[model samples]
Target: MTSTHADAHILVSMTYASRANPNVSATDFNEILQQAQINNAANSITGMLTFNKDYFLQTIEGPRAQINRLLYILISDERHHDLQIIDTRELKHREWAKWSMNYASPTEENAAIYLKYSTTIGFNPYLLNAESAHGLMNELSAQKG
Candidate 1:
């Protein structure tokens, strides 16, 4: 079954990646995540966020209005730059039904997972295509559980 919002016919999912702004600190990222959790829960959004010190790869699923608002906020947020949208599609169901905002940090333990989808020596999400990025998020989310 499909869920509808006033602004959209059905639920949708969006994936995007961005480079962390140089001035953003760990504390800043923490604050961002906290705020996202609160806002996303209130808006009935679910997603996963994968980030390291360098970049952020995220996939959010929800009503189109809420997703559009979040994308605008992300574009305006100073903590990240060069936002690259990987994909957006209507969803019959959410991929992240259980998470308001699941978080993952790619480290040595998950280097192989990153490499499986990454073209660079490290976790550079900019090099990933839509399918690879989605696959990476699915793998990370499974590992997270």
Candidate 2:
């Protein structure tokens, strides 16, 4: 069934671990980001991704079913496993409207926010706050020719 958000957007924070696949590397990650952008452009979905070591934290926003379907595909993909739902909320506006997936390499600054949320949610925050999390993404965009 198709689901739509009339006055708000559904936000989902999820955590997953890579499957130790030999094919899964930084380049593969970049390709995933490109694919996400294509999908988001067509669907008007938005989100961000943060990675620390082998753990991944992501937030997706869109129609409820669309976001859930995307998450399902991500969690079910063979390249990742141990999928966990960290948090979910309804937002009045789209936080990452311009990008389908903003990617960040986790660092000390970002970890602070991730740790705080992790403590509150009883799970390790694989993702940082949207504010700090976007720094890496901005850097990535700057490097693109």
Candidate 3:
């Protein structure tokens, strides 16, 4: 169920994880986000990425085919490892329509939200169930971009 502008398909939402690159600096992540923003905006993609010290959990939504392609690229990237998709579904509409790629990195100010929805205060998505993971993503999506 791929999509083009004219032959539009269902919105595909996916969540995936990878090991955080230990050496990558904040500047590097900002560069990555900058690139993501440009690419997502061009492709009409909307999603959020949550990064703690050890893992990354991201949920992306866009055309089915475009999502497929992006997944392929993500899997092939060497910056991280243990990459796996936790959820994928067809959506009638996008959940994060205003976001190109909203990055929600862990911080003291934002720790409470993660603590509330996550299994524990450590807030690791890798240990979360599909429902919890998606619930956390939904909460993140509602935040101001």
Candidate 4:
């Protein structure tokens, strides 16, 4: 969903390096997303996660208290680190209907997009700059052919 200035939304974007666990495969990541959906559904929170080879970028928005609580858990979890809060403005409804964690394999094309936006905005796609993060999401969404 498109966010407007009038909406009350808090956009927290963060990225971190993957843990050095050999068993953390694609299936494990998928399971995390599944669990996130179940957990967030219970709390009325919605968000999305995007990951590449060694980085993760996610956004969660909902009631301030609920989102903050979830984020605390997420940040403290052993799975990720170097967390950065991108934007925490007020937004209306969620941009995604369900909690989804999407995986994107790094390619020249994807890397190029990340580099371009990172250079221009001073925030890596792995981190969070609203414009760059949203742009990368749009790019990935458009490529779901």
Candidate 5:
């Protein structure tokens, strides 16, 4: 017996972090966000992206195949490098189902929220536990509202 995309019905969530390419301009980041929202919504994916000047942290949930395809795209994208997957899990329901790709960039108003999830004042997803990473996104989402 073999499993295929049709046979894989489980929803999965993936959390990852990457160092942003220094040369990537605001226009480039906006384009990436726009593309991700369009692609994710079309594929029934939902997620949140958080970034600072130096890094990107994101959590995405969807069908296994779509998530895998996203991972592949992330690996090949030149806008960022040193991609690291922080966690992957089979999900019962999406944490951010309402968002195709909600985005957040740290501001002074929310700096404390980032600090709550990080060991230091700066936001660093690599240092975060899976639980904290999701918690951080949830908090950020609340702030967005």
Candidate 6:
């Protein structure tokens, strides 16, 4: 049976640190995005990823089991650290249903969207709460495709 957002088991929103890994080059980042799109599509997962110089804030929604599985993988992945689940709740609709993994990196043209949630216009996830984190992801997702 198919599931609507309300019928879905979970909707998770999280923010995490990315400083645990070495600087990612464009090739490496693109590779990660490619893999995420493939994997997320297969698993019925949908999310948006927003990254700046220091942190990664993502919002993922899908089956509870699948989300849990992804979370496990993320925790074990050494590419990032300090995974923080900022919000978890049942929702009526998926905010990012259009893409398996829509992503955005702050740039000169789009820094404003990413910085709207930050107090100092810096892309620091640590200074944000669950609401702001979700907002940040939403803004980033709206930046481009």
Best by lDDT: 5
Write model 2 residue lDDT over 14-125, tens digit each, in one string.
3333332445788877777788888877766887766544566666777666776787788777766676665566666776776777666645555544454453543233
Q: lDDT per model, in order?
A: 0.87, 0.59, 0.78, 0.59, 0.88, 0.72
- For each candidate, what TM-score against the reference? 0.91, 0.63, 0.86, 0.67, 0.92, 0.82
lDDT of 5 by residue, 1-145 (tens): 2335692478999999999999988888899899999999888889999998889999989988888888998999999999999899999988888889999988878888998888866677889888898888889889978
Q: For candidate 4, lDDT tens digit of each residue in 1-145?
A: 2323342344433333333244457776777778887787776666667675445677666666666677778778665566766656566556665444444545656766556556544334544456667677657655643
TM-score winner, 2 or 4: 4
Per candidate, the number of residue pairs that clash is 0, 0, 0, 5, 0, 0
Off by over 4 Å in 3: 1-7, 118-121, 141-145
Candidate 6 has a TM-score of 0.82
> Over the stretch 9-120, how does candidate 1's per-residue lDDT look in tens digits?
5789999999999988889989989998998999889999999899999999998888988899899999999999999999998899899998888777777788888666
In model 2, the Cα lDDT at residue 111 comes to 53
In model 5, how large is the Cα lDDT of residue 3?
Answer: 30
Q: What lDDT does candidate 2 reach at residue 56?
A: 63
| Model 5 clash tally, residue pairs | 0
| Clashing residue pairs for model 5 | none
lDDT for each residue of candidate 6 in 1-145, tens digit (9 for 90 to 100): 3434553555544344444366666676677788889999998888887776566777778777677778889888777777777777665677778999999887887877765777874667777887777777766666675
Model 4: which ten-residue window has the lowest total lDDT?
12-21
TM-score head-to-head 2 vs 3, winner? 3
Give model 4's TM-score versus the native structure: 0.67
Estimate candidate 6's alpha-carbon lDDT, on a 0 to 1 scale.
Answer: 0.72
Model 4: lDDT to the true structure: 0.59
In model 6, what are the clashing residue pairs, if there are any?
A: none
